[model samples]
Target: MAELRPDSANRHRTRVKIVECAARLLRAQGAGAVTTRAVAQAAGMQAPTIYRFFEDKEALLDAVAEHVFATYVAGKSLADPSGDPVADLRAGWDTHIGFGLANAALFGLFADPGRGARSAATTAGLDVLRARVHRVAAAGRLRVPERRAVELLHAAGTGTVLTLLSVPPEHRDPGLADAMYDAVMRAVLTDVPTLPADDATAAAVAFRAVAPDLTVLSDAERALLSEWLGRAGTGGDRGQRDA
Candidate 1:
């Protein structure tokens, strides 16, 4: 129906307006300031109208987070991958840290595991991180499995952000974020090769990409090969038990 389009447009606009109002309140006064009545007042609407757009305060805050993250990503200059996936990952890390620092209240909300699990923005950011990690894995710079690299990066980055935010601006260590990034990088990646060498980690990383396509192996055999390659790339023995 022709009327449906106008109604949909109005609804979308109102939803965005509400999200922006809530975001402003959140940034100015923290999460406790983001009640339904406060957001409705800030948006110049009645309290009950907020319910129509978002099921509850939690859902509304999630929208506010996505709005803030979308704006941050929009302002970022997307880097061109210059055939060096490790460098590319490093650049992405800086941008991520910058975004988190600039938006502390929003970051705090998403840093909480329970709240973060409910955030679409957090999930989207992780998806971007996964792509970056996969790029490194595909380029053979990663000495660990792609899954392990992703986990390490996510954990380290989030931990760094939370740590930085826990301290006040004047007292925060200037090099802490970079130091943490380098530590995680050392664990995840190997030096880029300039010439052929007997790097078992590199060999395993390169082979892992093609392991699934090796039709000679059955499903079981392919799975076994994958496990072996993951451990090989990690510079550890697959069969060894940790003490």
Candidate 2:
């Protein structure tokens, strides 16, 4: 067992070295440059040894993405929950955009739909976003449901990054992201004066709005509750109209 220790240590070191090399190549020249031959050469290992760690190029890229995104996320000076949830959310949004713009090459890897869905690091990032959205919900300010807000923010943020990256740096619109965020806010937030009034119809609608965001139920159960809530909210509105 003692003799096995040295071999295990060597393999771990080699794996890290290979991943680091692949990541560098990927960053320097995009995904096309991370071939096994290139990585092995960069890491001072035979091409066959590369397969000892990663099953294939996709697997290796996935590891590279996981490592890179995780490192970037860890490095962020994430803010603590504060007095204003919307301000907190905006801070997070700015940080997300900064990271994507700074790491365009690596950001593209996880942005691809085929790979993004399978990435543990991307999922972790979504969880963080969800928590931020949840803070808005907990503050009683999220006009849209929590899940819908998350989906909207994810789409808007990802789209903003990709759109900016598509343009040359000099031609890119500096205010586009802020404008998009404003559009999303306009659609998702309620003005204080026009918030739903305190009444049966309004109360039902409020309850229904959050029904889908509840986590106490399974997916099927949540779906059923959302359906029921929809009916209840509609019926309340109809009754109010009749009266």
TM-score, each model?
A: 0.81, 0.77
lDDT of 2 by residue, 152-235 (tens): 999999999999999999999999999999999886655441244633333334565566678898999987776665454455
Q: Give the range of the ten consecutive residues with the poorest summed lDDT in model 2.
A: 234-243
Lowest summed lDDT over 10 consecutive residues: which window, candidate 1?
234-243
Residue lDDT tens for model 1, 1-243: 555588899998999899999999999898899999999999999999999999999889888887897666544435456677777789889988987888889988778788777666667777777777777766667666677777788888888998999999999999998999999988877777412265777667767756888999999999889877777666675432110
Q: Which candidate is the best by TM-score?
A: 1
Considering only N, C-alpha and C atoms within 3 Å, which residue pairs clash in candidate 2? none
Measured with C-alpha atoms, the lDDT of residue 225 in candidate 1 is 90
